[model samples]
Target: MRVLLVEDNGDFALPCRQLLAALRGVQVVQTAASAQEACDWLRANPGGWDLVVVDLFLGQGHGFTVLRECAGRPPLQRAVVLSAYADETARQYARKAGADAFFSKTNEMDALLAYCLQLAGEVDGANR
Candidate 1:
């Protein structure tokens, strides 16, 4: 699975990149630090990404804007929110903004990994 990871923090992005790279058949094709950059990249490369993992808070923009940018993507292309501010309100907004799933960085990291593994066909959804 080709992934576009939208995260500004090097601390989180580096570890997330390493983990995703360790997964079979999964590769993080690119990284964007802000919503505008991510949107521009997506526009420049239509159908170029299979998954976009976005953090709700970016250095230059909010992830909701990124989600909005990806709202019209094809069904095969998924946009998931990975954030520290993953409260109920945030989740509801994320869903409305076109996120396929929302996972909290502090509480649902395992679920995020499982979701990635399942998407990569490395594991079954039932297992996740």
Candidate 2:
């Protein structure tokens, strides 16, 4: 599973990268710190990524923009929002934008990992 992670904070990004790297079937993990960078990367890679994990509050711009950028992705490709500010409004907005799932950084880390694992298993099954 190839993942593009959009996050501004090094503190959060590092752990996320490490965790994803340790997961089975996660072959590549890329990082984009801002909305422009994320959008640019998404455009450049078209249907290259299997999954995108985005943070709502970025250093510049927002994850909603990134989600919008991913709106045209193939159905097999997935985007998820992982935010510190994962309130009801944010979750609804993310869903409306294009996010397949939303996870709170404070309390839903396990759920996020579980979702990723499920996606990875699917990818593995497809490859088999």
Candidate 3:
């Protein structure tokens, strides 16, 4: 499986890479610090990526805007939102924008991993 992470913080991006690498199926992991960078990368890869993990507050452009773009593209629809700002309103926005899952950095890491695995179609989140 291939995954793309759009995160600006080095601390968060590093751990996300390690976690994706640790997963059994995930082999290729890519990172982009900004939404525009991610958009460009995805354009090059075009339906080649398995999943996309995006931060809600990207320090500049909003993740929702990127997701909106993804929704317009074909099956570029496998997306998840990961951020410290996991409020109900934010979650609703993500869901409306076509996110498969929404997670908080403060939540249990295991649960987050399980959710990601499920989103990647490797495992079932409901089984956890």
Q: Which model scores highest in lDDT?
A: 2
Candidate 3 C-alpha lDDT tens digits along 17-61: 898778876654578888888878888887667778888888768
Q: Would you list the C-alpha lDDT of every candidate in the order shown?
A: 0.88, 0.91, 0.77
lDDT of 2 by residue, 1-128 (tens): 99999999999899998888788878555799999999999999986789999999998999999999999788779999999998899999999999999999999999988999999998778779
lDDT of 1 by residue, 1-128 (tens): 88999999999999998888898878899999988999999989887888899999898998989888887787668899999998999999999999999999998988988898888773233235
Sorted by TM-score (best first), the order is: 2, 1, 3
Window of ten residues with lowest summed lDDT in model 2? 21-30
TM-score, model 3 to reference: 0.85
In TM-score terms, candidate 1 sits at 0.92
Off by over 4 Å in 3: 72-77, 121-128
Q: Which of 1 and 3 is the better model by TM-score? A: 1
Ranking by lDDT: 2, 1, 3
Per model, state how many residue pairs clash: 0, 0, 0
Among all candidates shown, the one with the greatest TM-score: 2
